[model samples]
Target: MDKFIETINWCSLRDIGFVGPRFTWLYRKSDGSQIRERLDGALVTSDWLNRFPSAKLFHLSSSASDHSPLSLRLVPKPRSRMAGKLFRFESMWLKEPRCAEIVQEAWGEGLREASSDVLGKCLESGDRNTRFFHAKASARYSKNLISGLMDAREVWQEEDSKVEEIVVDYYQTLFTSSNPSDFVELLQAVNPR
Candidate 1:
């Protein structure tokens, strides 16, 4: 095992961490002695790690064999558009000791500026942006507006008068109970579990 690890180190291959059980192979003896070992995994080169920073190795349960199966998942690199330019993540950046500190500092500065800008805009406007608000309200109203409705007889209604009648009739029928006292009979008929 030491020599094997030395070979892996010499090859510059790294193990992509696993997600499931610690042991991949299980052995049980008739005398009630059992052995468990992690013998299966995935190894990746630095280039592959750079390309797939979000790669994952899963240890799947095995029912027919003592050795569990391994599943490798490679997540594609994510690209984001920031200020009309593309931003990409490099896995090698994680090796830098100050990467986390630099990112946190930049994020904190940006967040402070953005928060102040938004608060200033809101304070200055103070709901005076009537056209934008009205437009959004009108858009929601238009989207929620029912163009047509189907009647109980399966007739399509497009006219405003007919649509209103259908809606009113629906609510009236829904609220006006024909047999209000029937709930007692329903409760009695339900068998206790």
Candidate 2:
């Protein structure tokens, strides 16, 4: 195992990494004792990593076999723009060295091709600029603006009109047309009978 790691490191290969079951290998002895450990993973060349930055390795359930099955799924293209699903990026990930490497590799080709490209640029720009990402992630502008129009259920059409109606009623109560007699009385406040 040591030799294998050494060889992979010497060759500049990187682990694609995986998620799911921590223990890939499980063994149960006749004495009623069981052992488990992560025994399966994939290592890849830099080129492969660059091509599939969002690629994920998921572990399948292990039943008859003690070793869990691993599968690789490529990151699909971003969804349609009109879907209203804006991308949210977390700046906390920038604190990790591996994250920077991933972002750098994702944009190493000198092209901002993927949605992740904006994130990589934000990280490279420095910590002070992280607010942009924070705002994007929070989406406060859109949310607050929509709040006055759309309610908690997100029913834009019906709720927006209801909100406008309520606002109109509120202002009308505050600034309703006043009687001219009230103004005439105020103008003659100092007059004697």
Candidate 3:
């Protein structure tokens, strides 16, 4: 149909970074008219295209459905495997009497006056350290909380009100007493300003 063709053309021109199979939708009527049109589409901004030059769109055929599937692919973003390993602190730093002092010392050392490049590196290191510490702390707290709940499984099995009360109190303590100072250094590292 004229409308379908116009729509495809309009989308193709308006959209940037389009690649792979062009057609999006295929239609066939019992009357024997086969119409294949690009009903589905994707558009990546110019900025994204420049940042991820190899990004591409993939079009797949539909075996059971009338519409074809569209997919986007790009190189996987890099991430640090050790970035959020939070449990380490539970065993290593949680009970250490000087843990707070150590953290403060590290914070001070990381942010001491330095060149722009050195400052940037220090900030990144601080951010990673903070993230790792917090993640571990949170995970430890959560695990303990879950264990406590599991211990009350028998009570909860008999009554829901008691379980709800325990849960409510746990959350109240968690939210109100949770300390952000533990990760302040990491936050400053990510945003020195």
Clashes of 3: 1
Question: What does candidate 3's lDDT look like per residue over 95-166, in tens digits?
Answer: 445556655775778832322333344445564564545444444443343211222333312134444678
Clash pairs, candidate 3, are 86-136
Candidate closest to the true structure, highest TM-score? 2
User: Candidate 2 residues 39-158, lDDT tens each?
Assistant: 888877656655665566667786789999999878543423336655555666566556666657767865444546545655676868465455443334323332233333544332
RMSD of each: 21.0, 20.4, 23.4
Q: Write the per-residue lDDT of candidate 1 for residues 37-132, one digit (tens) a residue.
A: 998888776666656655657787889999999887675424232235324344444544555766677587764333333334444556465344
Which stretches in model 1 have alpha-carbon errors above 4 Å?
Answer: 77-193
Error of 3 at 89 (Å): 56
lDDT of 3 at 22: 59
The ten-residue window of minimal lDDT in model 1 covers 77-86
How good is model 2 by TM-score?
0.41
Q: Please, what is the whole-model Cα lDDT of each candidate in the order they appear?
A: 0.66, 0.63, 0.52
Q: Which ten residues in a row have the lowest lDDT in candidate 2?
A: 142-151
